[model samples]
Target: MPLSAALLQTLHSIVGDKGFTTNQGEIAPYLQESRNRFQGHCDILIRPKNTQEVAEVLAICNDENIPVVPQGGNTGHCGGAVPQGGILLNLSRLNKIRQLDGLNATITVDAGCILQNVQLTADKADLYFPLSLAAEGSCQIGGNLATNAGGIHVLRYGNMRDLTLGLEVVLPDGQIWDGLRALRKDNTGYDLKHLFIGSEGTLGVITGAVLKLFPKPKARACAFVASESPGHLMDVFAYMRDYFGEQLCAFEMMPRFGLDLVLKHITGTTDPFAIAYQWYGVLEISTSRPNTNLQTELEEALHPLFDRGYIQNAVVAQDLMQAEKIWALRESMSEAQKREGGSVKHDISVPVSHIPDFLAETSHAVCNVVPGSRICAFGHVGDGNIHFNISQPETMEKAAFLTNWEALNEIVHEMAEKYEGSFSAEHGVGQLKINEMDRFRGGVELDSMRLIKRAFDPNNIMNPGKVVKI
Candidate 1:
């Protein structure tokens, strides 16, 4: 709905000159989705300085039936942050470390606080906040919590939903719901924070949150192991987890093709192993205690893989720099993939035990549908999530290869459903997978979701046409 002249004047009065902008040049960055796949437009973009200003703006928009798109750092991949019209609520100015209870292992931060900054704050206090993502440097806590972002450390620390304990939200009607309790166990009527956590801003605007923290790991060890197959890598993973326990913070899998892409496209990237192997698994074991000898524990546990012929070789990082370099290969996969052209990325997960079977079947099915499609499959296999991305065939045109997005999504999602997996794993429905929510989610599930959305946002002024359609 277009903002009335009176409404625009009133909004301008509420935020003042520094807070509001109608200039397209200044608003250009906030209008684009991360992949350049979804481009949205807005009449005005407002940078609210505090919760009161946010509430005031939301109240005006809600009263006028104007949609409000609450955005963080605009680093989301699924177009959740993209605004169609009405007001774009830019929360970057609201970034402030509200509180920190190091003794209790809890850190309270504003919605727009950059994730990397939060990590550093925790580190400064001799604690750790484990909600790490690739775009952590720019991705805001609000977006991370809204999407319930899953990252490399999910296997050890859980997702954003788990890391978050409480949230302060600006409701659809402009009322601030302060549920930021720092308690570990609360037998409340309902877990309201979880609703807004993964709601993708459809329910309400997440203004602030109290996140859980953990003791910083003092002893750390990393290994880059080569496996003949994913199943074999899982075998080694099982053994390592049994021996290393909670110290196994990360277990990332990378295909040879993925590594090759990084080596070719990204400068200063060197092969961890002398000879390229079919599959590579990067493992990191760490503990708060010093002199844990996690390296030996990981090494001994991996010895059986050779006898089973699952793993052929392994390289343990002797220093911090080498460990980082080894990790760079895994972290560089997505950027390197961009150079390959017309990539169809899937952030899907199956049961930890079923990963090998799912990969084998899904790769076969994807190949059947798009023959010669170069598969660049990798991700956190310890937690069952797989970044099953496919790059376009070298011979195909970029536009021509992208034409298979729909067919390819169906094939991959159907296979995941057969194995009781999600079509959209960590990345929220946003605009990308809203249609799939209907195709995959049960009727009762969809109905329940809509019912909740209606109960909270009957007018649907908050983030319209995203997540679930009412």
Candidate 2:
């Protein structure tokens, strides 16, 4: 159903001329995601400046039964923010830092504040915000909270759900729920904040949040280690986890194929090791105490792993610059795959011990189905989230390879399920993996999700056709 002129005019009145745009050119960017895999259409794009404006706009949309797609910074890998029809309610204009209590170790801000800006604000106060990712410079806090984003540092500091203390949301009926409490132990009934955190906008619009902060690390050390295979790397990870304990911040793994792609496509990046190995691991350890020689400690720790033959070769970064260079090899893997050709990506997770067997069996299964496909699997193995991405064959066309996306996804998702793992780990269930929810998560689990969706949004006007189908 098309939005009536009266409904559009009423929405315009709530936001005014500067906050609304019907121009197709201006609205083009908001209708598509960063990956360009999903594109949608909206009659008008509405940028609400504050929480009250957002409430008013949503209230009107709710009354008219109009579909409203709430978009954050639009950096999501899944198509969560892509608008289907009706109004595109963007939260970019709501950017503001409401409060910063350094002593309490919390920062309160509007949901539209850029993630990097929050990190910088915390840095200025000599504090730290540990939720970091590739899209931190552009992705908004609301989207991060909505998707419960997980980055490399999840091994130590938890994901966005753990970082968030409280949230202020505007429901589908335009009623504002003020649950923004910064208490560490709030045994209040039914922690409502969790409902919207990973709900992916199916419940309500996240307007503002109070996020937790941590002590900034005074010393840091990182190393890139080469191993014969993922199985060997897991042994190394186990030893390091016990040795470093709380000091261990990150542990990432990638195949040789992933590194080759980065070295070939990304400029000014050099291989950390002289000889290439089958698999590589990046481990980082940090301490809040100043003047700690983490580099020496990390170097001394690798000696035992070498003795055990768990690692083939290793390069411990002596300086900050070298550490970043080592991290670049792991961070740039996704971008490097794009330069090759069509890549079928999967954000899946399994038990830490099951990672090796899962990778080996899944790789074999994928290869059997799509012969000659290049498997570029990598991610935060410390937290058990692996980005299993497959690139097109050298001899195949990009379009032809992309057609195997669903088929390859089934094989990978089935393998993940067999290992008692989740198919969608960090990425939320947008339109992309809604069917997976039904296939993998059915009966009581899926039925409960639908019951909550209908209760919160009976009209289904809040991000309709997302997360759970009604």
For model 2, which pairs clash? none
Please write out the lDDT profile of model 2 over residues 1-470, one tens digit for every residue: 76778877888898999899899999998888888989999889999899999999888889889888898999988899998888899999999999999999999999999999999999999999999899899999999998999998999999998999899999999999998899889997999999999998989999999999999999999999999989999999999999999999999999999999999999989998788899999999999999899999999999999999999999999998999999999999999999988999999999989999999899999989889999999999999999999999898899999999999999999999999999999988898998999999999999999999999999999888888778
Q: Candidate 1 residues 299-407, lDDT tens each?
A: 7777777888878999888779999999999999999999878899888888888898999998998988888998888999998888889899888898999999999
Q: What is the Cα-based TM-score of model 2?
A: 0.99
Model 2: worst 10 consecutive residues (lDDT sum): 1-10
Distance (Å) between predicted and true CA of 430, model 2? Answer: 0.6
Clashing residue pairs in candidate 1 (N, C-alpha, C atoms within 3 angstroms): none
TM-score of each predicted structure versus truth? 0.98, 0.99
